[model samples]
Target chain A: MTPRLTAFNVVSLTLGFAFLYLPIVLLVVFSFNESKLVTVWGGFSTRWYAALLGNGPLLEAAWVSLRIGVLSATFATVLGTLAAVALVRFGRFAGRTLLTGMVYAPLVMPEVITGLSLLLLFVALDVDRGFWTVTLAHVSFSMCFVTVVVQSRLVTMDRSLEEAAMDLGATPLATFFQVTLPLIAPAVAAGWMLAFTLSLDDLVIASFTSGPGATTLPMRIYGQVRLGVSPEINAACTIMIGVVTLAILAFSIASKRGLAEPGRAEGA
Target chain B: MAEPPGRPAPLIRFEGVTKSFGAARAVAGVDLDIAQGEFFCLLGPSGCGKTTLMRTLAGFETPDSGRILLDGADLAGVPAHRRPVNMMFQSYALFPHMSVEANIAFGLRQDGVPRAEIAERVAAIVRTVQIQGLEKRRPHQLSGGQKQRVALARALVKRPLVLLLDEPLAALDRKLREDTRFELKELQARLGLTFLMVTHDQDEAMAMADRIGVMEKGRLVQVGAPAEVYETPATRGVAAFVGDSTLIEGVAGAFDGAAARLRVRAALGASSPEFVVAAREAPAEGSAVTLALRPEKLRLWTEPPEAGTPNVLEAEVWDLGYLGDKTLVRLRLPGGGTVRVSRLNASRRPEAGLSAHQRAWIGFDPADAVLLTR
Candidate 1:
């Protein structure tokens, strides 16, 4: 709280940000390199992006990853949101704590273990490893991320809002759909985005779960990286950065648009 | 959805209802009949189950036993939306995603109401709450007062059986909350809707409700007109929770049918005041008792009183607390306790007859104290 302490706090925060994002900045810069080798910037060019776009297998994998990411993220958001609501509002019945613990397991467990375990379970069930299996793996972890985000949001949301709706003529179901769900909409959106990002970035689980021809973008990237680092990978990283940046900017803009007036600065 | 105001029946009734959270009972055997056009208030302190009572009426919680009747029918197992009641949340839970108009119309839309009808009703309620021009604005852009109005509109547009307010004015500054309290009272009267409010603020409840039901630790201790409850609180908890009081423990000394009298011994140490009561609900003498005396009732005099002061005591001026309108002189009685005597500062005399640590006497009329059996 003192001036020196405040200065120190700011300095530490600045260093933290730099440490996390400096590599991404470097990655973006190198993404425009004309040369095949990412280590040397032979010249400024968009040829890597062109190359990234042209590779048939890479493009196919990226498309598959996008579909799986979107699907799994959607699934996780819906199920996670329901689970979060149930845990916070209804602290009843047996196994409540155990159920909550299970929901949070994937958030802490090593990804390799989860992937391997899920892979074994699928194999035992005679479920072929492919797009569906990879999606299942992503949802397993992505759901935990979504649940944590949504649960915190639900816990802080005014419980009276739901009551208010019911008192006004809404059934509990009506209150959930109208009042509770709308109030938690921002949290759901945030969770969805987070799940999508995590699913898109996942490699090990996808690798363990995927069958032939179902390789995800991360899997394809991992396979390519084994051969050697290339500017094409840098181009892919730049695209990822662009997507996240756009998302953050859009979220801020949306929040600002509704409450533009000064007198209504209260949280919705 | 908040039911629009044209319903033909009383909105909500709690018939011998009770609620318990684990071992802690929050609402116990409450039987309340809320009239359709009445503004009813549940007044209590924190953990008194006023909020829980409100939640039960809203259908967020089911009663452990008994039934909640709405519009002359049992609302058993009915979800919140199926019931025709809306609430104005304490925090004013406006939808962050939607504009004011959209938020107001949320319930209507969900009920499959016509779009035109929703728009018209939204506009009407928004105008009623005076947030007309700001219909396009979202909740975050609104001030505390504006958000409250929007919440009111959202709940009112549906015109449900009852509009439940959970400490609606608690978040605002003193000035804003005071103004909004009046506005809410006025709106309730004008609409003639069954307005059920849950609040810990006694002043707000007294200012607004046709009748105030004081809850204590999940039970309705007393329900009456504000004056009746103030004149005679049914229990010590109600007296203590409602407002500031000087509580003195006593024993029931004597009683005749004409005027039952209580001999209450003061607890502040020195000597106790004989609580002279016209009538009270207390057993015979030698019973432990308590009495509540309002601060304004006690008269302070610097000069010693002539012997006729029936319940009088010598006191040393311990502390002097000054308000703009009145000065409170806290006097240490002959007994270890202190009595607060409030006097109007009509004349701004610099050393106005009394100062801190001065010797004094504080007394009250015979009827000033109420005997509490507890």
Candidate 2:
């Protein structure tokens, strides 16, 4: 049955969404302010957005962040999916509990601790801390989130499907690719999006691990905001929000289409 | 274990196969053989290792000890994918993402069969299973019965030497299950493929199988035709598991070797009647035995039988279960023991008309009562 929306429910729902999105809404509105002061509302103008085009360092940081987000999320997804499959399917091997604990430890660990540890490890190893180190750190932490997403889906999957594939004379590898992968694609896609977003906005880890050449968009924004919150910064934040929103919308639409096609075919 | 004289070598053989999960044995020392083109059923209650035994043949579960030979070739280390056997999982396990045609053609594609031939074989199997118009639909788009047919078509398209079905009809509704039982039997016969089905449903095994093997606690207790297993169960476990039977505890008195009959003193509390029952082999004199009597075998009489009538018992009607085709009358024996008598409702008018608390006389032929010594 559909739930009837009472006055109390409507008030609570509105309050919850307002609390979560009010700041984002304010920032988006102020991004078009003609006045340089961020707090005061001025006449609407696109000057801040135009000013965003000429900022070389900010654009470079944005480009770097995009590359890191894509590369780290892709690598993390592959590694996380493998880990999920091993944990779920390879029944009860030695030290399985310890491996599972280590895989999920980063999820609950403070980012400060993870960043500090990575920084120390890079220093002890004498490896240069730059784009690669930041990317590695992001992969290390975000892979756990990916594992959590993919593992839940794998746990609920019907194991008999794989058995059926093998019983039909498909080899184990073929069964995995043809049967298991296609079934788990949605979870994998969701995990990729999560990891990508996490890597994109990671400031503390990037600050700890990155060196002279690599500055992520979040790090650059933080650096700029420390001096003073500017309309230009608001514009950059608005653009970031727009990109993330568009990506999520595209992903959900693609997944819904994948699900709805079967129903449509049945109707035909 | 002995092969029939005229039959050829068995198609699949499980020679002393045993498997255990941790401390619990699932399939313990099961030795069996199935002839080609035979519909063999593994019948047992749940957790009796019936499915585990079938999995051993499918190469899904390896036997801890002993050998599984397929056409005289030992199947040791032969993976499930390479085995010349396919299984229709109980859950159907139809690929949710694949179209029915693609699901059916999966095996042929794996073998690198030509695209044209793959389509041809897929079409043929689809037509055989009578799901031709639904080829483009995915599994979730189809109904339960349609999904079942697709699962069957997928397994049969490969033309494996043997088809293993793990409770294949278990997911269907009761009416559909009944219809599918006959359809499956007919399909097996028409295809001339060796089929080994695992089920806990006695009626399904009885209706479909050429022979049934009754498993008990991971061991096969009896293997025979349905009638043979029901009428002449090798052990008390098989008797109790295969069908509803009233087991009367008794002690063997003496065996008349010439007549092939054994005398048993039943242990009903007050009126302990001595009965002469037919048996090929008798337990030692005075050894405890159980006499398994099928409810339908007993004749219910409103009036008492003649004084000299053998195997007759006097009992009061305890309850009446009015099944559509037959009525089961539970009778309370004079000694506080209970036995059931099933009377077929040939005429629609409630034949005996005996209500609760009414006295009735029940009797069965000596041959109908099976003496189980195990």
Candidate 3:
């Protein structure tokens, strides 16, 4: 059947996409400008890229953000997987309602509130705000995304596989490792990627918790934007977008290829 | 294959086993014994608690109050994995990710058996169930029959003392199920292992079980050989449950030593039918009773027999069903009740030369009818 595409729908779709993406496209195009003026287009050149390469503080902030993304993503994946398992597999127990609320509340909670609360918590605990504080804040919020992703997959899993493993004489712990874990591995990988991207893109919580000498990439970019709109900041933003898009593309392609391969015949 | 009538060191015994989920008792007070090396079946309709009873023996559910003895050992507090029993789940429960050989060898590997021994045993079982080339295929890639064989191979490779099969053939098509039923019985006999199966299919249970326990409403109403349960049911419910049987409600008149006279009244309150039914224990005088008669036991004749013929009732053929092997004739008795009589099609077009709405006489011997007190 042919889809009914009216004139209003065509106009609305084009306008909506242009509204969402035109600014990013303009920023990317201007990052390659040869002239220094921000609005006027110039001939294509990589001079801003050259300038961004030599910026010491920007490079340090990028490095700090990368380290925090990797570490917090890894920790969040582990903790979130445990939380998903407990919520999905265990029937019911004391404090289950409270635990479920804590796992999902951050997904809808306002970023400013989360940031302010974390700042107050760190200060009240008398812990110095620095790299560790930023990493902890990112982990606390991004872990909720991982939990939601993995929990959905856990809910649809066939529970009989676990029962079959235990019925075949494996202990409960052995069954979890050999059967349940392998079945939900894809969901866990997806959750980890989600956590990594969330931590990498976060600016509010990191800015609120980070101390002097611990600026992340977003904080550094915002500081530069506050001073003056520069092509260098646009260049940095474009690079960050490229890195995240490439990571997501790689993950999707790798998972698709994994699925395309035939089931491995162990004995043969 | 026949043993003495007495209990001969049963491999599994359930004594007053009862289990409840919330307020509903899924398995109420029940005591049963399964002899070693015997093929026993718990047969009933759906929701009859047969599956729940089997699950208790598999150690999946702990009974509320009673003892499950395995080889004379109390099975209380035994976890499912620790029990010396394995179940072929109704769904087959084959791991979707594993190859057939891996699935069959899973239990052996769990016991820390040597790799060489596990491989050898798995291969032998594969050949035993005749699933030779499908060893490397995953479960989803195989046909239903192949999955059934793989499940059977997996359950047998564990070498449990008593194998609990939960409708092992329920998932297969009719032909494949019949073939597998024969193979399962033969395997049980050759291995000399106790086989306790649960099924809602009466024909499957009758064909495979050495003894069948007919259950209803969370209780075992009757337990006997297939012929014994079909021929002499303990109650009206058991007679109607095990197979197709026509029940006649009557009231006892006179109780002689061997036979009791009953007067059956038609539903419209016009016609009165009388017969002498043989009973092992006769009911009291002027009390309600039921006579259970199997369809095959009644012979339908177009012309009434001689005047002295006993246990004969005049009926008009209401419906005629021509099954391949036999013709089932539903006859409306003079008392406004219907009774089914099955006649073997010994010859082509051998339907007693009878058709629907034709007058016929249905007769049976007094010894073939069972008198039910309830």
Candidate lDDT scores, in order, read: 0.80, 0.91, 0.85
Model 3's TM-score against the true structure: 0.91
- The Cα error of candidate 1 at residue B299, in Å, is 2.7
| Model 2 spans with C-alpha error above 4 angstroms | A1-19, A247-268, B1-7
Residue-wise C-alpha lDDT for candidate 1, range A82-101, written one tens digit per residue? 88988998868588999899
| Per-model TM-score versus the true fold | 0.82, 0.94, 0.91
Best by DockQ: 2
How does chain A of every candidate compare to the true chain A by TM-score?
0.86, 0.91, 0.92
lDDT of 3 by residue, B1-374 (tens): 24368857788899999988888888889999988899999999898899999989887788999999999889998887888888888878787778999999999999999999999999999889999999888887888888878888898899998988988888788898888889899999999999999999999999999999999988988999998988888888889988999988777776666344444332323566777766655567778788888999987789988897778888899998989899889998776878999988888866656888999998888778888886
Please give, for residues B1-374, the per-residue lDDT of candidate 1 as tens digits.
24458854445678888999989999999988777788889999899898988888777788899888887788888776676788878777676667888878888877889988888888788779998689898776778788888888888888876888888888788998888888988888898888999988899998888999999888888999888888788788877777667777776776665555555555567555565665545576687777777788887778988877767777899888888788877877776876777787788775477877888887777687766775
Docking outcome class, model 2: acceptable
Q: Which of the predicted structures, 1 or 2, would earn the higher TM-score when compared with the native?
A: 2
lDDT of 2 by residue, B1-374 (tens): 46679878899999999999999999999999899999999999999999999998888899999999998889999999999999998888888888888899999999999999998999999889999799998787788899889989999999999999988888888999899999999999999999999999999999999999999999999999999999899898998888889999999999999889999999998878999999888789989999999999998888988888789988999999999999988999999889988988898787556899998999989899999999
- Considering DockQ, which of the candidate structures 1 and 2 is the better prediction for this target? 2
Candidate 3 residue runs with Cα over 4 Å from true position: A246-268, B1-7, B260-272, B333-335, B350-352
